[model samples]
Target: MVITVPATVPIESFQRLRIETYTDVAAAALLVYDYLLTFNVEKSLIWPSRWNIMKVLFLLTRYLPFVDVTLVLFYQLKTNISVETCRATYFPAGWFIVLGIMVAEIILTIRTWAIWGRSKRIGIILGVSALVAIIPTLYIEKVFLDSLVFSPYPSPATPGCLLTAGNPIIAASFVIVILFETLVLTLTLIKGVQHYRIASGRGFVSVLYRDGVVFYIYLFGISVVNLIVIVAAPRDLANLLAIFQRVMHSLLSARVLMNLREANQREYALAGMQSSPLQHLSFSQSRSSEEDRLSFRRNLDGTVIDIS
Candidate 1:
């Protein structure tokens, strides 16, 4: 097979690539530093819990890409490497990025499941939706891999994967993720609001409302920004935005999970402390002629239903 070598990029494109490399390195360093600082607090608690496991995976997914990309950059900096080898690196790097995003999305789906009071139906629906979304994503990944070609004359500084040959499919892939996330976030909000009516004063419910909204806003805003940047910005600049998007996904997803766990722990502790000879509020669903009704059952022991 004849090798199709990519042409050297323009000076401006080379500069953009340099900036992307530097920024990615800085972001990765910051993520590592933050993870280490909190290691003592989270180390024992992370692996055993299912939620924590997903969070850990999300973090790894983010970190691994940085390592892979850094190595590719360094390899490009060296001389005498075959174009094929350098071009080959993009496949795995891209896969890492796609896998990380999928993991993050799964975490969000789980969070939505819990927010919906562990409804099996909601979980199933979201699961199916996620599977459908992955089909198109995998197609996009293939397109990206097939498009990978290194510049024929490698620049001294930037000699990695060049802009993918024109492909609208790659540009539109972000929308699939954005729509899926928006659906998850909307479901979460709906469930939260419904539960909030009855569980408004409860600590766990309040935590959900506070943290869940913030999480959705952060991810949603960035996804929109990423989509726009990919479509509108020059390819080199678009690449930077894409990397930064993954960084934010790692940071925010992990942050929200950690905060929720901490809040749950605190609520559990406070409930234990405040146990008194008060009546426990037990909720019951009643069917009436017009609609369903909610009734509370009182218990002799002073424990309220521990929502946390």
Candidate 2:
């Protein structure tokens, strides 16, 4: 028995598609990059410092692949390419995103360990989940390779990669992940709200309020809609879903970047490092003795600070 595969898109068609996809990736990646660039390390009200840095790295690794996958999917839709073609091309591109998620899981798992402190029960719950839930799910995606197109009409036009877990596995996996994400997000929201209530001073609540609730609500909504679209109107909503997924991906990532920056800022503030010259004047008032003051006129790298 012989299996047929996607023919390469016509060079002209592929080039045009490539450019279009490239343009899309460029726009998408830039949104993430700009968010990173503009992100001030003083925004995320509930940052885990080391974890946030890992998140920054995770974002850098993950988002590009997402952009690449977006571009590949765009080409597939535009050129009427095969799903196999989409799978083959997107597989490599998606690796980075998967890698990022893996890293995030690791980083977050550790944080959960810390947050789940003194509770061997929840820690073990998360540990078992990391092994049981995330690992096997990743392995299952491998089935996409060597998978066939299950479409009834055997035509090259309706090209796409078909895998074994179409209805059953796909449905199950999506449900589990969505459910898990909902629970985790809920847990995070509860913790964040409590922290906000206990917080003192002005501007504290505002930071959490900024992206905290809005962003999670957005993510949770996206996950639900994504599952709904995948199950109910997979083909009908391709164009719209692609755009929505891309935007949602950007929003989720941008929040992580912003949160990382905010976490760092809080550490500085807590450490008494984020001080003003006026505050320094108050310190110098009582202890006006010899060698009591130090000059901060140096504009060198470490000497310079941005209070803004």
Among the numbered candidates, top TM-score falls to 1
Error of 1 at 118 (Å): 2.5
Off by over 4 Å in 1: 1-8, 47-81, 154-166, 276-308
Instruction: Give the per-residue lDDT of model 1 (tens digit) for 172-261.
Output: 678988888888888877866775565534444456556666777888898898788777876666666665666667666665556555
lDDT of 2 at 42: 24
Query: Per-residue CA lDDT of candidate 2, range 184-289, in tens?
Result: 5555566456544544322322343344445556656765776776567533232233334445555454454355345435535643632655554433222221
Deviating ranges (above 4 Å) for candidate 2: 1-56, 59-63, 70-74, 77-87, 94-122, 144-168, 201-214, 234-251, 266-308
Per-candidate total of colliding backbone pairs: 2, 12
Q: Which candidate leads in lDDT?
A: 1
| Candidate 1 global TM-score | 0.77
lDDT scores of the candidates, listed in order: 0.61, 0.44
